[model samples]
Target: MPSSLMLSFLFFLLSLSACSLKTQTTEPEKISHINKENYMIPGINHGLIQSPINILSNEKHETKNHQITLHFQDEIKAVENLGHTVQLDFSKGSSISSDGINYEFKQMHFHTPSEHLIDGMTFPMEMHIVNYAPPATKNGIPHYLVIAVLFKMGNENEFISEFLTLIPKQSNNTVKLEKGRVKLHDLFHDDLSNEMKNYYHYRGSLTTPPYTETVNWFVLKHIIEASPEQIRAINDIEGDNARHIQTIYGRHID
Candidate 1:
């Protein structure tokens, strides 16, 4: 459902150079000292395709060409409270791919108030499934790919609540999910195989420290839901964990 304004905004994002997006600062350094107004990302942030950029719902940008596959047959390993947010890591975990490149799922995390915006619309929560692909293993730095699934307030997600209860409330705390008890795909829509095609594609960076522009972002158009109690539990642990949206820098959204 794209309008003229949405299309205009899409082009405008890709029209600017990377240098303008840099907001370098030397203020508070830790996540505890961080706020949306001040993200002490320790790196050169200028002149790159940074995230979380707004994803427009325009007809021209729609596609049936992307063939995305999600593979997560691994069991849940452990969950950690990394001060800023809660993260779920898998054991010898999953892989998602398209064409020939394989993206290995590293871990999954959450952000309240969402990160990447859709047509300037911010949702209640966002889940990022972090995956890495090694392309020509040079210096051992693998290519990063993140699949972002946004959430609205509605019926409770069984998959999410399945593990949400195991998350530690204190920062730097960690917990272990019962071995061989969980699956990654369960957190997604029941019809994910067919629904994942309707997504927004773009080249962007990590929303946290060392904000590198080494990511192939796949943001699904379909949103999942979290009940009121589930939302309260997440917020109670890590309130307002989202990073402010970044400038698109004129990079075309596929």
Candidate 2:
């Protein structure tokens, strides 16, 4: 009877050992099966992180490879109405060209009720001067350089008076550039105050859809003054044409 008991105990021990080995071998295969799904591992870089961006200061100023010449055209040849935006096409304008960056003015557009906010304050309106350059000069960068002009409430800006008249009440409408030939040199007067100082520089995406993040923003410290009447005129065209501010993404302020 004792011998029979011993044999039975041995058989039970062998069965238990075999089951443990089987479990160990199959566990790795189960993990391998999950790995084949090509799932992203946890802790990957998701868009959840909102980085804090730094505002640029004068100390961080660097030499701009490209310079722009502002021109005033008395008579516009064509006015294209892009819905929510308007363009004043010019035939000719002078631009400061460089080997690294060469920019030519394509057109000028406007956004009412302002698009950018300084310290959470909105301006009356903003003007965008669009320029284009070849990829070679831009180091294969795919972006259109836009110069933004912010307007605040003040005395009327003489150079901008005629340009504001052509803004259509409706979106996607085109108006002819009436009047005579507008000279570019006359638009930008010799105002020492107009120089861009105390600019906040940062890398940002375009506010428009497709949201290309190739733009380097240089928001001037001083606000340009415009007459209250001009602000009222812009409000007539667009009650709310500006976009919400985008994320700075923890970028360092210069």
Candidate 3:
């Protein structure tokens, strides 16, 4: 059966038992990284267009089919060590335009040993730059556009080094940064627009709790280089928090 038909059937069942359905409001004690049955999320175990699936480059050659108009400027957003990974919460209109919708940057976090694979291969680290598009609902969830950049071990990435400048040893802690001190350009190549255009587009969900299936994923083809020590430091803090890869569910990877 097609994934859409499968999802429709699953949700139809969910609706039948909606009154008795119970959702987990707290994190599970022992979550299964592979079998999402342990995730405790409502739609994860059944959501068709789930994320973190391997992108087989040979499956489709559509990197030339799209373009990116990312207008990101350096904003010294508050940097924090969220126990999961280091992150930057964006607010000052750092945005990307697609299909006439401007999805402004929300926050960016990391995964040691990338979640998405390129032709069955994994990178040392992956950065997820999440953005939110307008027409954002007050009650309903808004659409998201996530830009993924994978990092290979090599020379120290001075751009990523900015995050290392202030590492809060403990969780629930944040470090104050001077305005415009943390440059966004350090995160990407000089020719940001060109590199971003050559990317794999797909439909996926959040890699974490609630695992909402409302994201428009764009995994960049170009790989960024970061030093081994940088990668190791990140792992020491986060400790392999990546969820096991989800099934492709017959979804197209364009």
Candidate 4:
């Protein structure tokens, strides 16, 4: 081959190598930027009303009396160790109605180190009683009404003690329970109606994935009590799975 042709061929190979390196370097950087943006400000990617916001207890806001009614069977059929959290599954035929909108009780799950902060305070544990209502129209979004209960380290909680030992040892494992063995009524001291009366209601999303912003959050004003050992046992299984607090975004807290 001619000397000039050989030099030109070498230059072409070097240019191709440089372009490949440039492409490899910039691609990861772009992905890193996106991940960082999502981590720093989740609302930019998700919706405005996100779950686990810091609730300000002292803030004054307009309130409306929502005629809430509870028709609870309190029958827990199974207990699941989901790796992410301990869950208690309720049997069918239990529902709650607020202002004529009915939401059926599905299941309840826990979050360690509490998700929603009260007066800028995080409790030892939090339980979310998840309820759902189908969309009114085909194009309408599904609705969720999550009742949150924060637990502080104190006396052992009766409701938790019922199923704490019954939780399956392996992750994703479920153990069937005898009917009335693991009742949700025990959690509310057999008075769910009264316990639900004094709560701070707001609009938020699920703390977990999809983070859909159609949740009607009812964080109980009264913080419940649980033993430190019980809380630690649950945290050990779930680890630290609490989503960081999101901005309130001018949402009402009644």
lDDT of 2 by residue, 1-254 (tens): 59999999999999999999976655322432342224423753212111112233433545533333434332346666676666677655534232345566667666776776665677778776655665665456454555566788888877667667766667777777655634333444643224434455554545565444445455655566778887776666655677766454334334
- Residue pairs whose backbone atoms clash in candidate 3: none
Per residue, candidate 4 scores C-alpha lDDT tens digits across 63-82 of: 66778888988888899999
Instruction: Give the per-residue lDDT digits (tens) of candidate 1, residues 1-254.
Output: 47998998877886664435443322112222232323634555433457898777772354536567877576678888887787898777578787567888789898988998888999989989888887575575467878799999999888877788788877898898787655655666455556567678776778987676567788888888889788778877888989898865455566
TM-score of each: 0.76, 0.60, 0.78, 0.81
lDDT of all predictions: 0.74, 0.56, 0.76, 0.85
Runs of candidate 1 with Cα error greater than 4 angstroms are 1-44, 59-64, 189-192
TM-score of 4: 0.81
Instruction: Order the numbered candidates by TM-score, best leading.
Output: 4, 3, 1, 2
Residue 67 Cα positional deviation in candidate 1, in Å, after optimal superposition: 3.5
Give per-residue lDDT, candidate 2, residue 6. Answer: 95
Question: Among these predicted structures, which one has the highest lDDT?
Answer: 4
Pitting candidate 2 against candidate 3, the one with the higher TM-score is: 3
Candidate 1, TM-score vs. the true structure? 0.76
